[model samples]
Target: MHIKQATPALKAVAALLLTAALSSCGQSQNAGMPAAGPASVGVITLQPQDTVITRELPARISAFTVAEIRPQVGGIIQKRLFTEGSNVKAGQVLYQINPDTYQAAYQTAQASLAKAEATLTSADLKAKRYSQLVEIKAISSQDNDDARAALLQARADVATAKAAVETARINLAYTRITAPVSGRIGKSSVTAGALVTANQTTALATVQQLSTAYVDMTQSSTDLLRLRRDFAKGALQNQSGKAKVKLILEDGSEYAQPGELEFSDITVDSGTGMVTLRATFANPTGELLPGMFVRARLEQGVRHNALLVPQPAVSRNQKGEAVVMVVDRDNKVHARTIKTSQTIGDKWLVDGGLQGGERIVVEGLMKVQDGATVKPEPLKSNASAAK
Candidate 1:
């Protein structure tokens, strides 16, 4: 009975020893292998670059020059010379007023001048004859003086008549109306036989130069100040040292040609607190018309050391702050809030909270959280390939 019990104990001890050895072997095997870690994620490293700052503003297309056609002299329109809505050259005749009355007045003034000249001639002969008579005692000294005074009066009358003739001539020439400027003329306000007054309040027609166009835009005073501040701090540099502008048509198409920024209003509008800015563009095809609504993309300046973060990497937190998942030096992920100023293409212009060379998690964001170690894979950019 003792031997049987002893054999059972020995078997139990052997079984225990076998189980312990197997456990130790399994632990050693696992120890030799690597432990599982956090998952991998796609990331992009931040880089500082030079970027241009541009803004689009509401604008209006206008003519480079506008002239209102008005009559300088009052007259009845005899005939319309130029076709309505046609291009006109400077000093081109556009209307013909009836010159009948003016012609008659001119002739009358000429007759008056002739009559005054005849009288002057008679006075001259009488004055000479009277002076000769006085010298020989043929007439009194008083008679010679009277004759000289008549001659002076006659000369004055001739001068006055000559001036009247010139006035009449000018009035006759004014009967024909001409274009004051070279441009596309609008429709005529009055047809032939219609009477018009001199310098009337209503214009007879309008002309606009369409070869070059002006784009008028309004910007807030605050924005203007900010740009000035940037310039003062040297944060922005002008590549061409010129504020270049571009036009966007009403149909959402960009203008083929670029433009130059010309003028800015010194005074801000009190009603809207907006400053008016003007830009000029070449419109050889007459595509830009007066009063047409458009938009202007103004290149403010170029900024250096600009940090751009891809838009896919940005997310808004519960507090409505823009945040991103940043990977640290030790491969640990951290949630960081970033300040973004504007958007450049498909990226956010990172203004604060991140530096160049820092990596941001772009993919597998949902797979990892703060303090989790990750395998970061560099993101391949399509734009780089295109470049």
Candidate 2:
């Protein structure tokens, strides 16, 4: 029985030795397979700077000046003097009216003026002779007085005739319809031989000045108020009280010319709760047309010490907040939640959570996790462009 108990003890010791040998062999195999190093990740260092924030609003283009052509006198239109859609200068005659009646009236007034002048000359001679006779006691004082009165009446008649002549001359000149402003004229509403009256309700043609254009942008009153409030709080400085504007065409292309803010309407549209803001732009090529739809982007404010991160480094979390993987000074990876205000190109403008002088991973994101050590490398190309 003692020999059997010793044999069982020997078997137990052999089993324990086998287990130790297996563990040692497994550890040796793991060591020979090569231990994995830290994950390789591409990182970018962020710096703070003053960044301009722009707001885009829908806008419509309008001409700088608009002129409506109308006749100043009553007459039959003799001819249309200008080609439709042609540029016209101020004071340029655009239409010809029948001036025969006005010419006749002018001539009649001139004849009346000449006859009155001749009568005045005769009366003057008679008055002078009567004055001499009266002085020599060769004629009664009442006769001289009557002669002087007749001369005065003749002079008054001449003055009245001169005024009538001037009136007729002005009326004759008005027969020619002229342009009130220099601009491109639209199609004529009245054709040749069309009758027009003085101060007619209908316009003969429309002229629009297109060398410079106006961009009228409509923005919500609430947004405008918020911008004003931000401005007042020193968040934005309206440099020189004029902000620069950028134009975007309907096809999603930016306009070559830049513009400046002109004014903001004080009254809001009751129906839309929106305020109109005007911007002036150079339209030398006439590319901007009146009533054309467009978009205007203008600097709303400047954010000081703002951090911008490359979009590659940013990801969305389960809570829908923007998250980025930040590599700390220890080279350890950590997920960061940051607030973003807007996207400037391919970078996100960080509003909060993350700050300047922090490093964030931009590449090799799949190889990293929270609490994992990483091999950090600078992000290529994007750093120079972002700056």
Please list the residue runs of candidate 1 whose C-alpha ends up more than 4 Å from where it truly belongs after superposition. Answer: 1-40, 120-156, 239-241, 363-368, 382-387
Which regions of candidate 2 fall more than 4 Å away from where they truly are? 1-41, 115-160, 240-242, 300-302, 311-321, 331-337, 363-376
* Residue-pair clashes per candidate: 0, 0
Each candidate structure's TM-score, on Cα atoms with residue i matched to residue i, is 0.81, 0.76
Question: lDDT (0-100) at residue 386 of candidate 1?
Answer: 14
Residue 198 in model 2: shift from native, Å? 2.1
Error of 2 at 45 (Å): 2.0
Report lDDT per candidate: 0.90, 0.90
Residue 19 displacement in candidate 2 (angstroms): 21
lDDT of 2 by residue, 1-387 (tens): 889879988999999999999999999999899779998888878888777878889999999999998888899999999989889999999999999999999999999999999999999999999999999999999999999999999999999999999999999999988998999999999988888999899999999999999999999998888788868887666666688999999999999999999889999999999999999999989989999999899877786777888888889989999999989999999998889867886788887888767888888999999999999988686466355
Model 1 residue 217 CA deviation (Å) reads: 0.9
Give lDDT tens digits, candidate 1, residues 101-182: 8899999999999999999999999999998999999999999999999999999999999999999999898888888889
